[model samples]
Target chain A: MALALDGVSVEVTGATLVRELSLTVESGEVLGLVGPNGSGKSTALRCVYRALRPTTGAVLLDGTDLTALSLRDSARSVAAVAQDNHTELDFTVAEVVALGRFPHHQGGGALSEHDRLLCQEAMRRTDITHLADRGVLSLSGGERQRVLIARALAQQPRVLVLDEPTNHLDVRHQLELLSFVRHCGLTALVALHDLNLAAATCDRLAVLCGGTLVAIGPPADVLTPELVQRVFGVRPTVVTHPHTGVPQLLYTLTGENNP
Target chain B: MTLTKTTADHPPARPTRTGLALPVLALSLTLVVSVVAGVALGPTVVPLPDTLRYLGAALTGGTIGADEVSSYSVIWQVRAPRVLLAAVVGAGLSAIGVAVQAMVRNALADPFILGVSSGASVGASAVVSFGLFAGLGVYALSAAAFLGALAASALVYLVARNRTGVAPLRLVLVGVALAHGFQALMSVIVFFAPFGEAARSVLFWLLGSLGSATWGALPIAGAAVVVAVVVLVRSSWSLDVLAMGDETAASLGVDAEALRRTLFLLTAVVTGALVAVSGAVGFVGLVIPHLVRILAGAGHRGVLTIAPLAGAIFLVWVDLAARSLFAPRELPLGVITALIGVPVFVTLLRRRAYLFGGR
Candidate 1:
C-alpha cells in the first residue's frame, strides 16, 4: 500500500502544530520519520490514522482519499503502535490481542478458528505468546509494549504506523520489534527518536524540524554529521557497523552548546 | 512437577475464548440463589415453611386458601415486587455503568453522574410535593422522573457541546456543573416548600430508594433493562477496543464519534428508566466495572457480561443488610451504598493508583 500525505497541515487553538508537510511511503518499504518532541511527527501519523483532520491538504491511502473512507475501512488498512498506550481497564494479554481483529469480524457469529489462530500468530511474532493469560496491568513496561505490538499485528493491516512504539521497551525488544517489522514486508512508517535505530531499521529516512520535512533519503545519506548537528544540535562521529553495515552515531556532549 | 511461568513475557500466541455457556451458567446460578434467598428475607419474618409453600404454589399451578392468605399476599404482592425491583435496578444500573464508562472513558462516570438522576428527582418531587401529577395516580411520579432524566441529559449534552463536539473532559465537566445546578434548584424548592414534611418526602426521593417498587413497575423496568443489556452485549467487542483509547481504536477502524454517541444515548435511556423507578442508584456503576475489570480483565465483552450479574448480587446483599441493620426501622438504601462504596473505594485507592483506568 502507498501512504501519502499531500500538503497536510494542522492548527489547534490558532497555533499551527504541523506546517504544510508532504511525504510518501511505497508499499512494503520502511520509512523512518525522525524529529524532536512536538515537531509534529505524531501529528503527521495522526492524520493518516484519522485522530486529527489536517487543517489543509489531505492524507491518502493508495489513491483513495483517507477523509472519504469510513473509520472501519481505514482501520482495516492501517495499524498503529502509539506512544504512551495505557489501558485504563486491565485486560488479559489474549483479550487485548483479540481486539486487533475488531475490523474484520461482523457481529452474530462465533469467532471463527481462523480469528483465534491469527491472534495467536501475531502474539508469537511479537514474542508475547507466553504472557497470554497474564493481566496487562501487571506486566512490566517492556512486556506491555510487546503486547501492544501484538495487538497491531493482530489487525493484520497492510500499512503499519508506529509512533515511538519502543518508548518504554528494553533494547532487546526494540531491536526485535523493528527487525520483525522489517521482515514482515508491510508498508511501515515509524517515528523514532533514536538516530541509530532509524539508520539500522529503515530503508528510507525523513527528517522533520519545526513541522517541516527537511531531508529525505537512505539512512546513511540523510543522517550525516552536518544534518545531525543542524537538526539535532549535536556533533557526532559516524561509523559503519562491521556486521550489519548500518551507520552508527557516536556523540560528544563535551561541547559548551551540547544537545 | 510443576513448571515455572516465563519471566520474559510474550504476547499470547493462543486465544482462549470465554464460552457463552460458562458465563451463562454462572448467571443462572446467581439468579436462582439471589431470587430464592432474597424472597426469603423481609421485616415481616414469615416462617420458612410458609415462604416455601407460597413460592411453591406460585410456581406450580396451585392455589392457597384464606388461612395462609396474608402471608401469601405479603410475599407475592409486596416482598416479591421489591426483590424483583432490586434485581431489575441492579441489572439496569450496572449495565448503564458499563455503557457510560466506555463512552466517557472515565471510571468515575456512572449513568447518573451526568445529572439525569437529579433531574428525575426534581421532576418526581415537583409532582409529589406540589401535587402536579396527582390525578395521574401512582404511576405519575415515575413517569415524570423518566421524562425529566431524558430531558436533563439531552440538555446537558447540548449545553456542553461545541463545534469541535463532545470530548470526555467536556462531558464530565458539564455533568458535574449541571448536577450541582440541579441540586441547587432542589434546595431552592425545598426552602419555600408549602408543607414541612413535603420537603422530607422529596428529599427521600433524591437519596435513592427502591421502596416504591410495585408489581406494575417491575415489568416496565424489566423490559427497559433487558433491551439495554441486549444492545450492549451485541456491541461488546467495540466497547472493548474503545477502552484501550482512541489512537489504537481508530487504527483498528472504530468510528469513535459514532460509537460514543450511540453509547451515550443507550446509557441515557437505561439511566432514565432506572432512576425514574428507583431514584439515583449510585456506585453500582462506578464500583462494579472496577471489580469486574480486576476479575475479567478490561474487555467489555467480559466487563459488560459479568458486571450485571455481580451488581445484582451485590445490591441484593446490600439491600438485605440495609433492612436488617436497624431491624425494626428501615435504613435508606442510599445510606448503605455510600457506607459500603466509600470504605471499599478507599481501600482500593490506598493500595492502587487510580481506578477507572487511572485517568
Candidate 2:
C-alpha cells in the first residue's frame, strides 16, 4: 500500500506542530523522515498512524482517505511502533506479540492456528524466539525493541509507521534493524535521528525543519554539507563509504563554533 | 549479543493452560465451601448437619421437623441472603477493580477511584441524616446513593475529557479531587444531623455492612455483576491493548477514547448498584485484583475469571468474621477487610519478586 499525506497540518494548543506536510511513499518503498529535535518528524508520523488527526487535509492509503475507512479496516493495513510504546503490566513476549492479532479476531476468542504461526514467525525473524516466554519488563531495552517490531510484523500490515525505532539499540542491532526494515518489502515511514543510517537504508529521504519539508530526494542530493549544517547546526565532512557507496557524515569538536 | 546471552542464561518457563485451570478450579471450590460455612457459622451457630439439612430442605421444598423450625428459618431467611449478597458484591468489586486498573492504566486504581463510592456516600448520608428520598421508604437510601454515584461519575467524565479524549492521568486526578469534595459533603451532612443515633448509623453505612441483605436486593446487584463480568471478559484483549497507552491502542484499531468512555460508564453503573446494596466496602476492590494478577499473570481473562471467585471466597469469610468476631456487636465489613487486606498487601509488596504490575 502507498501512503500519502496530503497537505497535513497538526496544531496542538495554539502551536503548529506540523505544517501542511505533503509527501508520498510508493508501494513497498522505505521512506526515511529525518530531522533535528522537535522538527515535527514524530508529529508527521503520528498523522500517518492515526494517533493524531490532521487539523486540515487527509491521510490516504492507496488513494482512499484514511478517515473514510473503519478503524479496524485502516488498522488491517497500517501498523505502528510508536515512540511512546511502553507497558506497565508484565506480559510475556509471546502474549504481547499475539495482541497484534486482536483486530483479526473477535470478542477475545482464542487465537487460531494461523494466528499462532504468524506470531511464531515474527518472533523467529526478530531473533527473539528464545525470549518468547520471558516477561517483557525483565528484558533489556534492545530486546524489548525487537519484541515490539515483531508485534508490528505479526499485525501483517502493508504500511508500517515507526518512530525512533532504533533509539535503544546497540550499533550492530541498529544496522540490523534498519536493514530488516529496508528489505521487509512494506511501505514504511520511519522517523529517524541518525542521518547516516537513514542515508544507508532508506530508498529516499525526506528532510523536515521547523515543521515543513525542506527537501526530499535521494540521500546523495539531500544530505549535502550545506543542508546538514543549516538544519542540524553542525559542520559535517561527507564522504562515500568504502564498500557500500553510501554517504557518511564525520565531524570534529574543534570547529568554527569554538569561542 | 547481550540479548542472546541473556536469553540463554535465563531459559523461559512458559505458563501452561493447566497452570491457570488449577487455581481457578481451587478458588471455585473454596468459594462454595466458604458460602456453606458462611451460612452455618454466624453469631448463632447452627450445627453443620442441621445447616446442610436446612439448605437441602429449602432447595428441595422438603418438610422439616417442627423442633427444627427456628434453625431452618435462621438458615433460610437471614444467613442465606446475607451470604449470597456478600458473594455478589465481592464478585462485582473484584471484576470492576480489574477494569478500573486497566481503564486508567494505573496499578493503584480501584473501582471506587472514580469517586462513585464517595458519591454514593453523600447520598446515603443525606438519607440517613437529612431524610432525603423519604417517600421511597425501604429503598430510599439505595436510590439516593445510586443517583449520587451516577452524578459524580458523569462529573468526572466531563472534567477529565478534552478534544482528544480522557487521558488516564487527568481522569485519576479529577476523580481524586472530586472524591475528596464528595467526602466533605458527606461529612457536612453527618455533622448537622439532629440526633446522635443518625450520625452513628451514617458512619456504619459509610464503613459498610451486609446486615440489610435480603432476597429483594439480590437480583439487581447480581444481574449488574453478571453483565459486567461478561462484558469485561469479552473486552479483555482490548483492555490489554489499552493498557499499553492510547497511541498503541489506536494503532491496533481499538478506539481508545470510545473504549475508555464505555468502561467509565459500565464501571460506574456497576459500582453504583453494588454500593447501593452493600455500602462502601473497601479493600476487596483494591487488593483482590492484584492478588489474582500475581498468582495468574497479567492476562485479563484469567485475572477476571479468578479474581471474582477469590473475592467471593474472601468476602464470605470476611462477612462471617464481621458478624461473629464481636458476637452480638457486629464489626463493619469494611473494617475486617482492611484489617486483613493491609497485612496481606504489605507482605506482598515486601516480597523481592513482586512489583505492583511488573516483576
Candidate 3:
C-alpha cells in the first residue's frame, strides 16, 4: 500500500468521530470510500490529508509515518481535492494552479520556468488551458472544479485524495472526471456519495458504517444487495455493465423491500 | 450551476503587468513629490528653494549658513518631523491593513477593527485624565497606549481562537465586540474627568492627530513601519495561501494556525506603535489596501508594496491639507481621512468592476 491508515481514530471532545478505521490504497489504484452520510468517511480521509490528526494510530505513506514529515514535505507527495474550497478573491486560473508549486519552492522566489511548464501541463490535462487568463471566479461550477483538480495535479503528488469531487458536477462531467482520475496513473483515494459511480470506476471500495470499516474489497464482491441494504438502508440490485462487465447498481425507490 | 454573473459584456480583465507597474511607479513618484509638498507647503510656507537646500544640507550633514537659519528651523525642526511622522504612520496603518485583511480573510478589516485603536485611546485618555503613568512624564501617553493596544489584541485573540484555529469570521466578531467595549470604556473615562481641558484634549487625541510629532518619536515609528513591511512582504506567499481558508492552507503546506497567530501579534505590535504616536489614523489601514488591490492585483506582494507608498502619499497630502488648508486651527487627521476616504471609497465602489481584484 502506498497509503495506509493503521487503525486510525478521531475523537473530538469525547465523541468518537472515526473509530479504529483502517484502509489501504496500493500504488496506482483508485480506492473508493463509500458510506451513508455521517459514516465518518470524510473524518477518516481528513487524517490522511492532514486536515485532522488521528487520536490513536498513524497514517503511513510508503511505510513511513506521515506525522514524522513536515507539512511541506508531506504535501509534496500527497495532494487533495476537497469539496468546499470557495474563494471570493479573483485569482487567475493559472495563478491558482501555480499555488500547487508552493511546497516545491520554499524560499519564495518567482515561479521557475519548470514550475510554469508544470502548471501549464496540469491545466492542459484538466482541459482548462484555455481558461488560463480568466479569473477562477468567472468559471462555471464544472470549470472551477477542473481548475482545482488542475491545482492538485500540479502538486505532482504520488498519492491523490479527493472528497466528493463530483458533488456539484453534472452527469457527463462527472463520468469524464472519474475516468480521467482512473487513467491519471496516481494512487487515488476517492470518497463518493454515488454508489453506482464508485462501482463503475473504483478498483476496490471500502464501506464505512458509523465510524468503523465494515468491508473492503472489489465492488462486485463487496457491494452486494444485502450489504447495500444493511449499510445504506437502501436495497440496490447489482447489475453487470454489458460493455465493461463492471458492477453497476440499480436502485429502486418503489419496491416490496422498501425500507 | 451556470449562475454566471458578469460585471460587463466584456472579457475578464486580468491586471496587466504594465497596468500594475505604471501606477506603482507613478504612485512612487507622487509619494516623493508629496513628501516635499508636505514639508514645503505647511503653515509657515517655507520657500521651495530653501526647503530643497535645507533637505540637501541635512542629507549631507552640512550646517546651513546664517541667512538660511529661519528656513532651516521650519524645514528641519518642525515640518520635517510632522511630515515624516505622517508618512510613517500612514505606511504602518496601510501595511497593517493589508495584513489584517488577509489575516482575518475579510475585505472590510482594518487596523482599528481589532479594538487596538480604541484600546490605545482608553490608555491615552487614562494618562490624560488621571495621570496613570505620571512617572513616565512626557512618554506616558505613548507607553500607556502601546501597552493597552497589545493587551486588547491579546484579549481578542484569546477570545476568538479555537481548537481548530482562529476562524476568520470569529476573529472579526470578537474584534468588533472588543472594539465596542473599549470605546465605551474610553467614553466613561472622558465623561467623568475632573479637568474640562483634559477631557477636550483627550477628545482631540481620540479623533487622532500628528500635531505632537517630535524628533524623539520619529525613530521608533520609522523603525517599526520598516521592519513590519519587510517581514510582511517576505511572508507574502504564506499570506496568499492563508486567504484560501485554514484547511486548504494547511493541505497546501502552510501552518495556518501558527501563521495567523504570528500575524495577529505582528499587526498588534505595528499598530500599537503607530497608534501610540499618531493616535488612531483612520481609513488609511482599511481603504488603502483595497485601493491598492484594485489598481494592482489581490496578491499580497503587490498590495503590500504599493499600500505603504500609496498610504504614505495619501496621508502626507491629507496632513498637508489638514494643517495648511485651515491655517493655525488644524483639523484632526482622522476627520480629514474619513471625509476624503468615504467619498473616494464610494467612488471606487461605484466606478470599478475590478474592485478587490475581481471583475
For DockQ, the strongest prediction is 2
Q: All models, DockQ values?
A: 0.42, 0.61, 0.55
DockQ of 3: 0.55
Q: Residue A37 error for model 3, in Å? A: 1.3
lDDT of 3 by residue, B1-359 (tens): 89877656534657444434777788888888999988899778877888998998988998789988888988888888999899999999999999998888788899988889989988998999889999997899999999999999999999998887788889999999999999899889988888887778887887788888888999999999999999999898888877777677767888888888888889999999999998988888998988887666677777888899989988998999888888989898989999999999888867665534244
Error of 1 at B19 (Å): 3.3
Q: What are the per-residue Cα lDDT tens digits for candidate 2 across B64-143?
A: 99998998988999999999999999999999999999999998899999999999999999999889999999899999
DockQ of 2: 0.61
Per-candidate iRMSD: 4.6, 2.2, 2.5
What lDDT score is found at residue B90 in candidate 2? Answer: 94
Determine the C-alpha RMSD for candidate 2 after optimal superposition of all C-alphas. 3.2
- Candidate 2 chain A: 10-residue stretch with minimal lDDT: A250-259
**Alpha carbon lDDT of each predicted model:** 0.81, 0.89, 0.87
Candidate 2: lDDT over CA atoms?
0.89
lDDT of 3 at B218: 97
Candidate 1 CAPRI grade: acceptable
For model 2 chain B, where is the 10-residue window of minimal lDDT?
B3-12
Candidate 2: tens digits of C-alpha lDDT, residues A125-237? 99999888777877877888899899999999999899999997899889888888998888899999999999998989999999999999989899999999999998789
